[model samples]
Target: MDIKKGYIFPKPFWSSLIDVNIRGLQEECYEIRNNVPSKYKSNLGQNSYHSPNLLNLQNPPEILKLMKQITNCIQTIHQQSRRENVRLVDFWININGKGGSNVPHTHPGAKYSGVFYIKVPKEMKRGNLFFLRDYNETYLTSQENMGFFKQGYNLLPYDLPKIPVKPLEKLLIVFPSWSPHSVELNDTDEERISLSFNYILFR
Candidate 1:
Protein backbone atom coordinates (compact mmCIF):
# COMPACT_ATOMS: atom_id res chain seq x y z
CA MET A 1 0.00 0.00 0.00
CA ASP A 2 1.05 3.61 -0.63
CA ILE A 3 0.16 6.69 1.40
CA LYS A 4 0.51 10.41 1.05
CA LYS A 5 -0.29 13.58 3.02
CA GLY A 6 -1.36 17.11 2.08
CA TYR A 7 -0.29 20.47 3.43
CA ILE A 8 -2.53 23.48 3.97
CA PHE A 9 -3.02 26.80 5.77
CA PRO A 10 0.49 28.17 6.17
CA LYS A 11 1.23 31.55 7.81
CA PRO A 12 4.30 33.35 6.52
CA PHE A 13 6.81 36.06 7.39
CA TRP A 14 9.74 37.58 5.45
CA SER A 15 13.12 38.45 6.96
CA SER A 16 16.55 39.61 5.78
CA LEU A 17 19.50 41.89 6.51
CA ILE A 18 19.58 44.73 4.01
CA ASP A 19 22.70 46.65 3.01
CA VAL A 20 22.47 49.74 5.26
CA ASN A 21 24.60 51.49 7.84
CA ILE A 22 23.72 49.75 11.09
CA ARG A 23 25.66 52.22 13.22
CA GLY A 24 23.88 55.18 11.69
CA LEU A 25 20.52 53.63 12.35
CA GLN A 26 21.45 52.98 15.95
CA GLU A 27 22.53 56.60 16.46
CA GLU A 28 19.30 57.85 14.90
CA CYS A 29 17.15 55.77 17.27
CA TYR A 30 19.16 56.97 20.27
CA GLU A 31 18.72 60.56 19.22
CA ILE A 32 14.98 60.16 18.95
CA ARG A 33 14.72 58.31 22.25
CA ASN A 34 16.67 61.09 23.99
CA ASN A 35 14.67 64.00 22.60
CA VAL A 36 11.22 62.47 22.22
CA PRO A 37 8.84 62.01 25.12
CA SER A 38 7.63 58.43 25.44
CA LYS A 39 5.79 58.81 28.70
CA TYR A 40 2.67 57.25 27.21
CA LYS A 41 2.66 53.53 26.58
CA SER A 42 1.14 51.08 24.13
CA ASN A 43 2.25 47.44 23.85
CA LEU A 44 5.66 48.14 25.37
CA GLY A 45 6.15 47.44 29.07
CA GLN A 46 8.76 48.33 31.69
CA ASN A 47 11.94 50.14 30.61
CA SER A 48 10.76 50.43 27.04
CA TYR A 49 10.51 53.66 25.04
CA HIS A 50 8.25 53.93 22.04
CA SER A 51 8.94 56.94 19.87
CA PRO A 52 6.35 59.03 18.14
CA ASN A 53 5.85 58.60 14.39
CA LEU A 54 9.16 58.99 12.53
CA LEU A 55 7.59 60.06 9.24
CA ASN A 56 8.07 63.60 10.49
CA LEU A 57 11.87 63.38 10.39
CA GLN A 58 13.11 66.39 8.45
CA ASN A 59 16.01 64.86 6.56
CA PRO A 60 17.02 61.52 8.08
CA PRO A 61 18.93 60.14 5.12
CA GLU A 62 19.76 56.80 6.74
CA ILE A 63 16.17 56.30 7.82
CA LEU A 64 14.94 57.20 4.34
CA LYS A 65 17.32 54.58 2.94
CA LEU A 66 15.90 52.00 5.32
CA MET A 67 12.35 52.93 4.33
CA LYS A 68 13.22 52.47 0.67
CA GLN A 69 14.50 48.97 1.47
CA ILE A 70 11.39 48.17 3.49
CA THR A 71 9.13 49.26 0.66
CA ASN A 72 11.17 47.10 -1.73
CA CYS A 73 10.67 44.15 0.62
CA ILE A 74 6.91 44.68 0.80
CA GLN A 75 6.72 44.80 -2.96
CA THR A 76 8.83 41.65 -3.29
CA ILE A 77 6.64 39.78 -0.83
CA HIS A 78 3.52 40.63 -2.76
CA GLN A 79 5.19 40.08 -6.17
CA GLN A 80 4.21 43.65 -6.97
CA SER A 81 5.67 45.78 -9.71
CA ARG A 82 8.59 47.91 -8.50
CA ARG A 83 6.89 51.02 -9.87
CA GLU A 84 3.78 50.39 -7.76
CA ASN A 85 4.50 51.91 -4.37
CA VAL A 86 2.92 51.30 -0.98
CA ARG A 87 2.34 54.04 1.53
CA LEU A 88 4.40 53.90 4.70
CA VAL A 89 1.54 54.91 6.94
CA ASP A 90 3.42 55.00 10.22
CA PHE A 91 7.03 54.66 11.44
CA TRP A 92 8.45 54.61 14.96
CA ILE A 93 11.30 53.48 17.17
CA ASN A 94 11.26 50.94 20.00
CA ILE A 95 13.91 50.75 22.71
CA ASN A 96 13.60 47.97 25.22
CA GLY A 97 15.85 47.94 28.21
CA LYS A 98 16.29 45.30 30.91
CA GLY A 99 12.94 43.69 31.76
CA GLY A 100 11.22 45.27 28.76
CA SER A 101 8.75 43.17 26.83
CA ASN A 102 5.67 43.59 24.65
CA VAL A 103 2.21 42.25 25.30
CA PRO A 104 0.57 40.11 22.64
CA HIS A 105 -1.07 42.37 20.07
CA THR A 106 -1.94 42.71 16.39
CA HIS A 107 -1.75 45.65 14.06
CA PRO A 108 -5.12 46.93 12.84
CA GLY A 109 -5.98 49.01 9.76
CA ALA A 110 -2.64 48.21 8.11
CA LYS A 111 -2.19 45.45 5.54
CA TYR A 112 1.37 44.59 6.60
CA SER A 113 3.86 45.34 9.37
CA GLY A 114 7.64 45.08 9.82
CA VAL A 115 10.59 45.59 12.12
CA PHE A 116 14.28 46.47 11.77
CA TYR A 117 16.76 45.66 14.50
CA ILE A 118 19.55 48.14 15.18
CA LYS A 119 20.82 47.29 18.67
CA VAL A 120 20.28 43.85 20.18
CA PRO A 121 21.61 42.26 23.30
CA LYS A 122 24.46 39.82 22.79
CA GLU A 123 22.64 37.32 24.99
CA MET A 124 20.28 35.21 22.94
CA LYS A 125 16.59 35.17 23.96
CA ARG A 126 16.84 38.62 25.43
CA GLY A 127 13.71 40.34 24.10
CA ASN A 128 12.90 37.49 21.74
CA LEU A 129 10.04 38.00 19.24
CA PHE A 130 7.33 35.36 18.95
CA PHE A 131 4.62 34.67 16.40
CA LEU A 132 1.52 33.15 17.97
CA ARG A 133 -1.03 30.88 16.40
CA ASP A 134 -4.50 32.34 16.18
CA TYR A 135 -6.65 31.40 19.15
CA ASN A 136 -8.68 28.34 18.18
CA GLU A 137 -9.18 24.66 18.91
CA THR A 138 -7.05 23.73 15.93
CA TYR A 139 -5.94 20.09 15.97
CA LEU A 140 -7.79 19.63 19.26
CA THR A 141 -9.01 16.21 18.25
CA SER A 142 -6.28 15.09 15.87
CA GLN A 143 -4.78 11.90 17.23
CA GLU A 144 -1.30 12.73 15.97
CA ASN A 145 0.54 15.84 17.13
CA MET A 146 1.00 18.21 14.20
CA GLY A 147 4.36 19.62 15.25
CA PHE A 148 6.20 16.35 14.69
CA PHE A 149 5.56 13.00 13.04
CA LYS A 150 5.41 10.37 15.80
CA GLN A 151 9.02 9.43 14.88
CA GLY A 152 11.95 11.66 13.72
CA TYR A 153 12.41 15.37 14.53
CA ASN A 154 10.94 16.76 11.33
CA LEU A 155 8.93 19.86 12.28
CA LEU A 156 5.77 21.16 10.68
CA PRO A 157 4.52 24.76 10.94
CA TYR A 158 0.89 23.79 11.55
CA ASP A 159 1.52 21.51 14.52
CA LEU A 160 3.59 24.10 16.36
CA PRO A 161 1.76 26.51 18.67
CA LYS A 162 4.09 29.50 18.36
CA ILE A 163 7.40 30.56 16.79
CA PRO A 164 10.17 32.54 18.47
CA VAL A 165 12.16 34.92 16.27
CA LYS A 166 15.44 35.88 17.86
CA PRO A 167 16.63 39.47 17.43
CA LEU A 168 19.92 40.19 15.65
CA GLU A 169 21.49 43.46 14.60
CA LYS A 170 20.55 44.59 11.06
CA LEU A 171 17.78 41.99 10.83
CA LEU A 172 14.52 43.01 9.15
CA ILE A 173 11.25 41.07 9.24
CA VAL A 174 7.83 41.59 7.67
CA PHE A 175 4.51 39.80 8.16
CA PRO A 176 0.77 40.20 7.97
CA SER A 177 -0.45 43.03 10.16
CA TRP A 178 -3.10 40.82 11.71
CA SER A 179 -0.63 38.23 13.00
CA PRO A 180 -0.66 38.09 16.80
CA HIS A 181 2.81 38.41 18.30
CA SER A 182 4.80 39.53 21.35
CA VAL A 183 8.28 39.89 22.78
CA GLU A 184 10.18 38.30 25.68
CA LEU A 185 11.80 40.19 28.54
CA ASN A 186 15.21 41.75 28.03
CA ASP A 187 17.04 40.25 30.97
CA THR A 188 20.40 41.47 29.68
CA ASP A 189 21.78 44.82 30.83
CA GLU A 190 21.90 46.23 27.31
CA GLU A 191 18.98 47.77 25.48
CA ARG A 192 17.36 46.33 22.39
CA ILE A 193 16.59 49.00 19.80
CA SER A 194 14.42 48.39 16.78
CA LEU A 195 12.28 50.33 14.31
CA SER A 196 8.75 49.30 13.37
CA PHE A 197 6.39 50.47 10.66
CA ASN A 198 3.04 49.82 9.01
CA TYR A 199 2.27 49.80 5.30
CA ILE A 200 -0.60 49.46 2.85
CA LEU A 201 -0.80 49.14 -0.92
CA PHE A 202 -1.31 52.38 -2.79
CA ARG A 203 -4.86 52.94 -3.93
Candidate 2:
Protein backbone atom coordinates (compact mmCIF):
# COMPACT_ATOMS: atom_id res chain seq x y z
CA MET A 1 0.00 0.00 0.00
CA ASP A 2 2.35 2.72 -1.19
CA ILE A 3 0.06 5.55 -2.20
CA LYS A 4 1.85 8.76 -2.95
CA LYS A 5 0.42 12.20 -2.40
CA GLY A 6 -1.64 13.24 -5.47
CA TYR A 7 -1.46 9.68 -6.75
CA ILE A 8 -3.87 8.82 -9.56
CA PHE A 9 -5.33 5.37 -9.97
CA PRO A 10 -5.03 4.11 -13.51
CA LYS A 11 -8.28 4.22 -15.48
CA PRO A 12 -10.38 1.07 -15.22
CA PHE A 13 -12.72 -0.36 -17.86
CA TRP A 14 -16.13 -1.60 -16.81
CA SER A 15 -18.11 -1.25 -19.99
CA SER A 16 -20.78 -3.76 -19.07
CA LEU A 17 -21.24 -2.32 -15.65
CA ILE A 18 -21.32 1.21 -16.96
CA ASP A 19 -23.84 0.27 -19.55
CA VAL A 20 -26.19 -1.26 -17.03
CA ASN A 21 -25.90 1.60 -14.57
CA ILE A 22 -26.31 4.29 -17.22
CA ARG A 23 -29.32 2.56 -18.70
CA GLY A 24 -30.99 2.54 -15.35
CA LEU A 25 -30.03 6.13 -14.62
CA GLN A 26 -31.26 7.46 -17.94
CA GLU A 27 -34.67 5.98 -17.31
CA GLU A 28 -34.85 7.32 -13.78
CA CYS A 29 -33.83 10.99 -13.74
CA TYR A 30 -33.83 14.21 -15.73
CA GLU A 31 -30.81 16.45 -16.11
CA ILE A 32 -30.52 19.50 -13.83
CA ARG A 33 -27.71 21.87 -12.98
CA ASN A 34 -25.66 20.76 -10.01
CA ASN A 35 -26.09 22.89 -6.90
CA VAL A 36 -28.14 25.58 -8.63
CA PRO A 37 -31.29 26.95 -6.99
CA SER A 38 -34.49 25.30 -8.23
CA LYS A 39 -35.62 28.53 -9.90
CA TYR A 40 -32.57 28.87 -12.11
CA LYS A 41 -32.75 27.78 -15.74
CA SER A 42 -29.75 28.16 -18.00
CA ASN A 43 -27.02 25.87 -19.31
CA LEU A 44 -24.42 28.51 -18.49
CA GLY A 45 -25.28 28.55 -14.82
CA GLN A 46 -23.02 25.94 -13.21
CA ASN A 47 -24.14 23.38 -15.71
CA SER A 48 -24.24 19.70 -14.73
CA TYR A 49 -27.04 17.28 -13.93
CA HIS A 50 -26.95 15.36 -10.67
CA SER A 51 -29.01 12.25 -10.14
CA PRO A 52 -30.51 11.91 -6.70
CA ASN A 53 -28.21 10.14 -4.29
CA LEU A 54 -28.32 6.47 -5.19
CA LEU A 55 -29.64 5.39 -1.79
CA ASN A 56 -32.55 7.82 -1.98
CA LEU A 57 -33.71 6.82 -5.43
CA GLN A 58 -37.31 5.65 -5.70
CA ASN A 59 -36.22 2.35 -7.24
CA PRO A 60 -33.83 0.95 -4.70
CA PRO A 61 -33.17 -2.36 -6.42
CA GLU A 62 -31.70 -0.84 -9.53
CA ILE A 63 -29.82 1.72 -7.53
CA LEU A 64 -28.46 -0.99 -5.25
CA LYS A 65 -27.23 -3.00 -8.20
CA LEU A 66 -25.44 0.05 -9.56
CA MET A 67 -23.97 0.74 -6.15
CA LYS A 68 -22.64 -2.79 -5.90
CA GLN A 69 -20.75 -2.46 -9.15
CA ILE A 70 -19.35 0.94 -8.19
CA THR A 71 -18.31 -0.37 -4.79
CA ASN A 72 -16.69 -3.39 -6.35
CA CYS A 73 -14.51 -1.13 -8.44
CA ILE A 74 -13.56 0.90 -5.42
CA GLN A 75 -12.75 -2.31 -3.57
CA THR A 76 -10.41 -3.38 -6.32
CA ILE A 77 -8.59 -0.08 -6.10
CA HIS A 78 -8.35 -0.37 -2.34
CA GLN A 79 -7.02 -3.88 -2.65
CA GLN A 80 -4.27 -2.65 -4.90
CA SER A 81 -3.39 0.01 -2.36
CA ARG A 82 -3.62 -2.69 0.34
CA ARG A 83 -6.09 -0.37 2.06
CA GLU A 84 -9.23 -2.22 3.05
CA ASN A 85 -11.10 0.37 5.02
CA VAL A 86 -12.71 2.42 2.31
CA ARG A 87 -16.29 3.54 2.60
CA LEU A 88 -18.06 4.89 -0.47
CA VAL A 89 -20.68 7.64 -0.42
CA ASP A 90 -23.53 7.27 -2.85
CA PHE A 91 -22.85 7.97 -6.55
CA TRP A 92 -24.39 10.57 -8.87
CA ILE A 93 -24.62 10.74 -12.64
CA ASN A 94 -23.82 14.00 -14.45
CA ILE A 95 -25.45 14.75 -17.76
CA ASN A 96 -24.23 17.72 -19.77
CA GLY A 97 -25.43 19.14 -23.05
CA LYS A 98 -23.97 21.72 -25.40
CA GLY A 99 -22.78 24.84 -23.53
CA GLY A 100 -23.01 22.95 -20.23
CA SER A 101 -20.13 23.09 -17.79
CA ASN A 102 -19.26 22.51 -14.15
CA VAL A 103 -17.76 25.13 -11.90
CA PRO A 104 -14.61 24.39 -9.92
CA HIS A 105 -15.37 22.61 -6.66
CA THR A 106 -14.17 19.91 -4.30
CA HIS A 107 -15.81 17.04 -2.51
CA PRO A 108 -15.75 17.92 1.17
CA GLY A 109 -14.97 15.36 3.87
CA ALA A 110 -14.10 12.58 1.46
CA LYS A 111 -10.71 10.99 0.97
CA TYR A 112 -11.03 10.39 -2.74
CA SER A 113 -13.43 11.24 -5.53
CA GLY A 114 -13.69 10.22 -9.17
CA VAL A 115 -15.64 10.45 -12.40
CA PHE A 116 -16.45 7.82 -15.00
CA TYR A 117 -17.24 9.19 -18.45
CA ILE A 118 -19.80 6.92 -20.08
CA LYS A 119 -20.68 8.83 -23.22
CA VAL A 120 -18.56 11.58 -24.75
CA PRO A 121 -20.15 13.13 -27.76
CA LYS A 122 -18.12 13.62 -30.93
CA GLU A 123 -19.19 17.23 -31.41
CA MET A 124 -17.68 18.45 -28.17
CA LYS A 125 -14.89 20.93 -28.81
CA ARG A 126 -13.74 21.37 -25.23
CA GLY A 127 -15.52 18.98 -22.91
CA ASN A 128 -12.47 17.48 -21.27
CA LEU A 129 -12.28 17.36 -17.47
CA PHE A 130 -9.59 19.65 -16.07
CA PHE A 131 -7.70 19.57 -12.77
CA LEU A 132 -6.63 22.80 -11.18
CA ARG A 133 -3.07 23.49 -10.13
CA ASP A 134 -2.20 24.63 -6.61
CA TYR A 135 -1.69 28.13 -7.97
CA ASN A 136 -4.92 28.57 -9.89
CA GLU A 137 -6.26 31.23 -7.57
CA THR A 138 -3.23 33.46 -8.02
CA TYR A 139 -2.97 32.62 -11.67
CA LEU A 140 -6.53 33.72 -12.41
CA THR A 141 -5.83 37.10 -10.81
CA SER A 142 -2.70 37.54 -12.90
CA GLN A 143 -4.76 37.21 -16.08
CA GLU A 144 -6.21 40.66 -15.41
CA ASN A 145 -2.77 42.27 -15.76
CA MET A 146 -2.30 41.07 -19.34
CA GLY A 147 -3.79 44.23 -20.87
CA PHE A 148 -1.44 46.59 -19.04
CA PHE A 149 1.69 44.47 -18.97
CA LYS A 150 4.02 43.62 -21.82
CA GLN A 151 4.20 40.08 -23.18
CA GLY A 152 6.07 37.80 -20.77
CA TYR A 153 5.63 40.47 -18.06
CA ASN A 154 1.99 39.40 -17.73
CA LEU A 155 1.80 35.84 -16.46
CA LEU A 156 -0.75 33.70 -18.22
CA PRO A 157 -1.91 30.74 -16.22
CA TYR A 158 -1.68 28.25 -19.05
CA ASP A 159 1.89 29.30 -19.72
CA LEU A 160 2.80 27.95 -16.34
CA PRO A 161 3.40 24.21 -16.15
CA LYS A 162 0.11 22.32 -16.13
CA ILE A 163 -0.93 18.68 -15.85
CA PRO A 164 -2.58 17.62 -19.07
CA VAL A 165 -5.80 15.65 -19.27
CA LYS A 166 -4.88 12.01 -19.68
CA PRO A 167 -7.18 10.42 -22.21
CA LEU A 168 -8.69 6.97 -21.87
CA GLU A 169 -11.67 4.93 -22.95
CA LYS A 170 -14.48 5.05 -20.45
CA LEU A 171 -12.13 7.08 -18.31
CA LEU A 172 -12.25 6.84 -14.53
CA ILE A 173 -10.39 9.83 -13.04
CA VAL A 174 -9.55 9.60 -9.35
CA PHE A 175 -7.98 12.25 -7.19
CA PRO A 176 -7.97 13.52 -3.62
CA SER A 177 -11.40 14.73 -2.58
CA TRP A 178 -10.25 18.27 -1.98
CA SER A 179 -8.53 18.74 -5.32
CA PRO A 180 -10.16 21.50 -7.38
CA HIS A 181 -11.32 20.46 -10.83
CA SER A 182 -13.79 21.46 -13.54
CA VAL A 183 -15.24 20.42 -16.86
CA GLU A 184 -14.70 22.86 -19.72
CA LEU A 185 -17.98 23.82 -21.39
CA ASN A 186 -19.26 21.67 -24.19
CA ASP A 187 -19.01 24.10 -27.08
CA THR A 188 -20.47 21.69 -29.57
CA ASP A 189 -24.05 20.52 -29.80
CA GLU A 190 -24.12 17.15 -28.12
CA GLU A 191 -24.57 15.51 -24.76
CA ARG A 192 -21.89 14.34 -22.35
CA ILE A 193 -22.60 11.65 -19.79
CA SER A 194 -20.59 10.89 -16.68
CA LEU A 195 -20.83 9.75 -13.08
CA SER A 196 -18.97 11.00 -10.01
CA PHE A 197 -18.64 9.41 -6.60
CA ASN A 198 -16.76 9.84 -3.34
CA TYR A 199 -15.14 7.51 -0.83
CA ILE A 200 -13.68 7.83 2.63
CA LEU A 201 -10.61 5.93 3.79
CA PHE A 202 -10.49 4.70 7.34
CA ARG A 203 -7.75 3.09 9.30
For model 1 the local lDDT of residue 144 reads: 53
TM-score of each: 0.86, 0.63
Q: Could you give candidate 2's per-residue lDDT for residues 99-180 as a string of tens digits?
A: 7777767788987677776667765557767777556544663536433455567654443433345323356667777777
Which candidate has the top score in TM-score? 1
Regions more than 4 Å wrong, model 1: 39-41, 80-84, 137-155
lDDT of 1 by residue, 69-147 (tens): 8887887887653455577888888898887888877889987898889888887455778898766633552335434
Off by over 4 Å in 2: 1-25, 28-48, 59-64, 136-161, 164-169
RMSDs, each prediction? 3.0, 8.1
Residue pairs in candidate 1 whose N, alpha carbon or C atoms collide under 3 angstroms? 146-159, 147-159
